[model samples]
Target: MSNVKDTTKANNQLIYAKRNMWTGILFGFGIVAFIDEAVFHQLLHWHHFYDKSTTEIGLVSDGLFHAFSFFATIGSSFLLADLHRRHAFWLKRWIGGIFLGAGVFQLYDGIIQHKLMRLHQIRYHVDVFPYDLVWNITAVIMIVIGIVLLYRTQS
Candidate 1:
């Protein structure tokens, strides 16, 4: 009946909205990663921000990997979102877990690799920096927010 049709339409709209939101989030993060690695590191030569010389190259490589992963994940999310619209509990759980893991890894890397070990410098140079704390806090906030979103989005 009309009630059944209306319910189906509403469900379809909800699925579309959820898929679009995730797609936007993934693409936004991917773009940020690309800018950090490609534009900032490769093109601008902004200090690799790491202590170990060898690991400097690895940092850039990791950035690239992150960019590619983000894109791939986004693509997969869209496909899975479409296919699992009606039965998305498992899919949501898996994606949420992945995001949680990635966020934790980034948090650890930022603290130990970047801050504790003093492998990487914050600014492009050793000169006095005004907004260093801001940058660091922002990174921490992003990691926390990512984890929270992942946890909340999971069924």
Candidate 2:
């Protein structure tokens, strides 16, 4: 009976942690996307979400991307609230998820979007090497930090 109870408890903990982490990941991704879109795309006029075509098309793409970010943010917030209400939210695990998500998003934008898809550059007409290096390295660092945090939580 004791062993069975312990196993059930452990399983519940695992499930809670997983949920918290995933919620945090969504939050992080949405926040970063919002920042990138607002600062670089909108504020700085650096580039759009999709810059391969006319400005009008780019604006439309940006609007769609903004909508995605908004939905992700709201969805994650609701999830987090539910976890909190259930008293199952794990702060450390959630933090780890946040870092992981942000890093993953940034890396994807830097490599796949900026380079592979030719969607947009960090900046235009200027030397892009420094920008690319900084962007990629920062993303790697964030990912490492997130992984370390998540690993530690497992113990």
Top-scoring candidate (TM-score): 2
- Cα-based lDDT for every prediction: 0.53, 0.89
Off by over 4 Å in 1: 1-32, 49-51, 54-109, 117-119, 127-131, 143-155
lDDT, model 1, position 81: 65
User: What are the TM-scores, per candidate, against the unseen true structure?
Assistant: 0.46, 0.90
lDDT at residue 116 of model 2 (Cα atoms): 95
Clashing pairs in 1: 49-120, 50-119, 50-120, 51-119, 51-120
Q: Which 10 successive residues of model 1 have the least lDDT summed?
A: 87-96
Model 2 collision count? 0
TM-score of 1: 0.46
| Tens-digit lDDT string for candidate 2 (8-58) | 645655779888789988988998899999999999999999999999999
Q: After best superposition, candidate 1 residue 20: deviation in angstroms?
A: 10
Per-residue lDDT tens digits of candidate 1, residues 1-155? 99986677555545554553455345444444555556545676655534366765757665656567567557756755664555432334344444433444445445675667865554445662444555556556665665566566532
